[model samples]
Target: MRWWWQPRKQHGRIGRQVTALVVTTAVLLAGTWVGASRIPTRWFGPAHPASAQAALPVDRVVWAWAGAVTTTSATVVAEAVRPARRARLVLTADQAGVARSTAAVPVGGDGIVRLRATGLRPDTAYRYVVEVDAIADHARGDGRFRTMPSGPASFTVAVGSCARTGSSGAVFDAIRAVEPLLYVSAGDLHYGNPARDDVTVFGDLYRQTLTSPAQAALYRSVPVAYVWDDHDYGPNDADAAAPTRPAARAAYSAYVPHYPQPEPGGAVYQAFTIGRVRFVLTDNRSERTGTSLLGARQLAWLQRELVTAARGHAVVVWVNPDPWIAAPAGGADDWGGYPQERRVLADTIAAARIDNLVMISGDAHMVALDDGSHSGYSGAGYPGFPVLQAGALDRPGSVKGGPYSHGTFPGGGQFGTITITDSATSRVGVELTGRTWRSTILVSYRTTFPAPSTPPKPGTG
Candidate 1:
């Protein structure tokens, strides 16, 4: 809200020339620069010292996750030490005061509170404070999130996977620093013993992983979309036979704020649209079989969603937990193990000619990138889209890209960032940055999406 210009103490000819060059450069890329200027003020907050009251019982209000955010509605998932009697959410356009309040939201006995706040303005920035049972403001959890624009817009998203429970890593802090509009965990949010089917164990794992100061801060600030894989799915390469499958799905419903599952009581496969991009977050572990990765029903839904989105949106992003490329060391955990299903998906996309499609994958332990040449596509030489694999926030070990891998980020512990810039000219620019937990760039990919023709006006066709 405050702006100031500093006067140069002394500017010689050389200084004046440099300043002129800077201004000229800014003018040259003014269209791209326009997107940066629209970023919300104070979208990200600085780290603050915990107040004394924060350490008291009121501190039971631990972390909050924003989910299923559309233009006018958002779901907030808050965690407490004990089942909260009364939970409230105060929303404000500015961080200072409340514009509206959703008071007395019901909290379940599981210490998980889900609150939906509606009637928000589209593409607007809001800061929320969650208070449990008349807790003081200083002790409440506060963070900021922006509703997706109903019209053309530009935004950034950060993603990673395979984070172990009770762990901290630089990747968490780095993700927060990037200040994305949204964050997603492709799968394996926590590694709990897959053999256990107890709801308490799954709940405890989420608490231990998300309540960590660094990870909590990131989730609190940016809205998140979630999809689960093997570990979080209840075992190593768990499938339909996993004993805890039902409990796993139930716990996810109790905690994460996600779009409706493709099927009523099936794996957490859902699709959502934000601006000109549509995202398909798949559940690859559950209902898994030698015949298909998502089973028949979910696969049908995915095909329908992709075809629909391709006709309407400028870009489509598919979130696959397992790598689309051949498995490393002939491992059965990735798409290589489900060759039939992988081919079906690849062929479907190619046949439909879905333009501007980008696939993001997790659960691979190391960051890797590949063009569609190795994406299991058949009936043609290769598909044109790119696949980005990122994760292993706390694990150790790295592998190089094989015959199918184009850019392999060696070493362990990394995250992925996708930045999209929408221009007035109807062109969208995308940049993917793969970085280590320490913020070192390992590989980068860039592409552009030309504007699709607008749909026919209503009652005209």
Candidate 2:
């Protein structure tokens, strides 16, 4: 999606309905718009096929995304063109056959599988291999992911949003190279949204984006958490009032692996804690209204979670799909449009003195780094936290004009990383880094938060 300001003229509208045909045409025709080289080499031909060494009885099993992670459990999602009654997920502490197996449940008729693995050790490293059938085929030869720590620990996370199916996806490689424990995709995983919101269209769109080599490799290795944006949700600028909201929500549920959703029969907006970090991912499109981005129930849930996380976790990561800082001119589709709600959130954080909040967002097709000062509140009213915007993973565009805070870098296949390092003492170091397609650091910011003092030892005096 383009920036809110200068929408029609300067940036051109985000394609209303981004079908495979439209995406191919746009990438081929506008070679100069985003840059011809940015398009994935495989898009000109069929989507990347499985490697020659892939196992038999399956053409290819595409690894989708991973999430619903806890101290002892996590889910892996995948899809295949070949039909299979059951899928196998094997987790091994090492390569020497100390393995645990889990069964996968098939969702819908599209051959999508969700393998929910449990009984995992907390704060441990494990190598995993996903096999479509017990004896037949395996999607990934071997992949590795670390379970979330049960207690205070150090970890890195990659965050980004808005990727079309055809982009070269260099950022995905960069993210994998960083070896983040988790990667949060704020929204817009794919661009194809038919006007009627057909399930077939949704499945096709997902395959086009998820099966690519870069994305598949990333998901195979790193766990992912997702939230939806406008295009992926339905249409351009679509909202909760859309006629096809139910269908869209169902399609998302069928394909994407996520934590238990808070809003039943609506979009997925949920919270999960991994070690010292508490993640609150918001549903921006489904419940959005003129006054609030998140509906009343969701908003209340968020406020309560913020307080709970602030009191306990070393850092609270608030994931919103739209840019929270350096808002554009007219606030139609972003947090800026709903000033009262934004004010309430900011006021609550400030009044509570929640010092360890870091907001990560995507949608603007640019990377923006802000200290929360530009959120339009002043005079100690809004004690702003840091908001990092990692935009347009592969879509065409650069950083546009706005009241960018300390660091704002032009975007083109870029993502953001947040590394939290906990210590024995009462201090936690948090680092935020933004990088480009070729792994160049665009902006890096670091801050330390003093952890709450330990309780006095009982009866010491």
What TM-score would every model get versus the actual structure?
A: 0.82, 0.83
Off by over 4 Å in 2: 1-60, 104-108, 326-331, 376-380, 398-402, 453-461
Give Cα-based local distance difference scores for all models: 0.70, 0.69
Residue 64 local lDDT, model 2: 51
- Model 1 alpha-carbon miss at residue 116, Å: 0.5
Q: Which has the greatest lDDT?
A: 1
User: Can you give the lDDT of residue 153 in candidate 1?
Assistant: 75
* Candidate 1, 1-461: lDDT as tens digits: 22111111112211121110012355545533422222211112111111111122347576678988877888888786575687878889853455688867777787688878888888889988787786733343776788887767789899888776655555677788888888988988877756766778788888777676667767777999999988887878888789888888888888888876756566889887777778888888887876667888888888887877777777778998887777433447677777667677767877888778888988776677766666645567446577888765655434523343445643334789888887645677878777765567766788888766772111100
Error of 2 at 20 (Å): 25
Which stretch of 10 consecutive residues in model 1 shows the poorest summed lDDT? 13-22
